[model samples]
Target: MAKATIKQVAAEAGVSTATISRVLNSSGYVSREVKQRVMAAVTKLHYQPNAIARSLKQDKSFTIGVVLPDISNPFFMTICRGIEDIVQEQGYHLLFCSSDEKPEKEEQLLHLMVEKRVDAIVLATTGGNEELITRLAASGVCFILVDRRLELELSESGAVVDLVAEDDVYGAYELTKQLILAGHSVIGVINGCMGVSTGQDRFVGYLKAIHEAGLEHDPALLYDGHFTEAGGRAAVRYFLQMAKPPSALLSFNNKMTFGALVELTESGRDIPGDIAIASYGEIEAARLLKHSGIMYVDQKPYDLGIKAGQTVLHRLEKGLDKSLDRDAASPEPEPIRDILQPALKTLPS
Candidate 1:
């Protein structure tokens, strides 16, 4: 079977190729009667527009690229859903790639997105490639940093980029404070890698709570879980080996929380009995278990995605298209810093 062409559709519809193009692109207005005729012809011929040719002609790809640290994580998946809900209405497609928390992989993915001529990129950076990110943004690449960000402000580096994330510092502080208020003087922290902004901010928040409580900082209680399930299990084992273990525990993310729970259960430690456990993010499985009693901060991943989507759309509408060369003298718009507040949920034991 042969693929149908625009010319064939136009001929069948008894309309010029220009009219067919206008109708297909929904550009110039065509009469209602003509539109129906053209659509009918399109259906009969099964004509499909060449995406590459259309993008080249219009200077727009109608595609958004997304690079996430871990695509398998439900947290990131919710964010992707939010972004897709917004962009899909405007006839834009998403190209998703996971960097797997590796800098080299992230760098390669970023370059691939540019080569594919994506209209915009939503990234959960692995805290590497700040220089390259800055350079690309400066060169008129539309970037929205979601969940994680660089060390230095991109605007300060002369690269305007939008950010949509939760208030990690405050959320972690409040979560830690909850454990402190529950009368846990000695608390253990299953922390993530301190390389990314999220990891750093969350740790800072935990420290602030400890400082305010006048509790002596025990370096032994801190375990770097590296935001992985295996790391979480190892951290639990490390804490168990300590001569004076913490009465309470805090896991920074859902994955680590899960690992901690599994390790504790297998080791015959009762929750809220032997040790109270809190988390920076909610664990979905905890809800199914009776007497879970897990205190957590709800980071609205989907809402963060919505904000990122809205920001990118607004930038594109404001003539921040990657196809156009930005004028040097033109003042750049202030970078968007949208930080959503997290909710603390403390369930009864």
Candidate 2:
């Protein structure tokens, strides 16, 4: 039996070799119906689009590329697990890379993935280049934006994108409201930088809750945590040095909370006794903090990742439904946006 070739696959599918090439490359405007026929024929023959046999740049690599920020973070890693659960079963290999929260690093990684001819990309995104992302998605390589998303200006870019993330506003609002309801008027926040969308949403939710309670919004209490543990530690130091430190504190994400907790423990302050603490995400090393009260939201990181994986797979294999065509809307490829709610829990002091 002669090994299957593109020409053979095209003959088997009863379509022109040119059409077969376009479908395998996922290029041009072939109707889904025709695409399916070509794919079926290729599958029946167990065809492999080897670089030696054809134009390597135009063939589907059958690999999914993943780009994330702070790969050390368990939240994102759990999301990766979720994604792997689905994509791996479909016989798609995953190539994971970390952006280290740098947009330039992410850009470099993206180019590398394209150069390698990955079929699709699932990105946590550091923002800073919406047009590039749009073009890549429209260029036949599928892109799914997960975790942090593109800024609003490009949220509706005329490109097909899938987004799965935590509902930042909801998580922040719930945490802030919990502290306010507990009778803490003097509250401080270890917040992510406002330039980031997640950071901005969390801050806005904090403000919304504060305003609803008719409390004066004090700029002095706002500490930019810069989405880092060091930032949280520094915020803790700044707040502690104040003549009147806030009675309660809120850290936007778990990492910063860990930093603040470390600083507070060293300073001999008691949790919920000397001060109350609430945060948007869970803290690590729970055993060490047994004596302290720490309320946190479960960002559902793992489940969020699974959803992202499914969304990307859907776009690649099944494609998007015409009713919600992302390209038809201002955003073009209609984003299959999934926002999971963060569940709140608390430890008694």
- Evaluate candidate 1 by giving its C-alpha RMSD to the native, one decimal: 2.5
lDDT of each: 0.88, 0.82
For candidate 2, what's the RMSD? 8.0
Best by lDDT: 1
lDDT of 1 by residue, 1-349 (tens): 8999888999999999999999987899999999999999999988899888888888789999999998988999999999999988888889998998898999999999999889999999997798899999888899999998777666555677888999899999999998989889989999998889889999999999989999777888899998888878898899988888888889998889989988988999988788888998888877765676789998898898889899889888885533447677766678888989899997667
lDDT of 1 at 190: 95
* Per-residue accuracy of model 2 over 1-349 as CA lDDT, tens digit each: 7779888898888889889878876777788888888989988999887653453653666688899887888888888899999888987778999988788898999999898777789998877867788878666668888878776444444466777888899888888998998899999988886666788899988999999999888999999988788988999999999999999999998788888888888899888789888988787674467667778887788888789888978887765433444454332445687888788888756
**Residue 330 error for model 2, in Å?**
15
* Residue 295 miss distance in model 2 (angstroms): 1.0
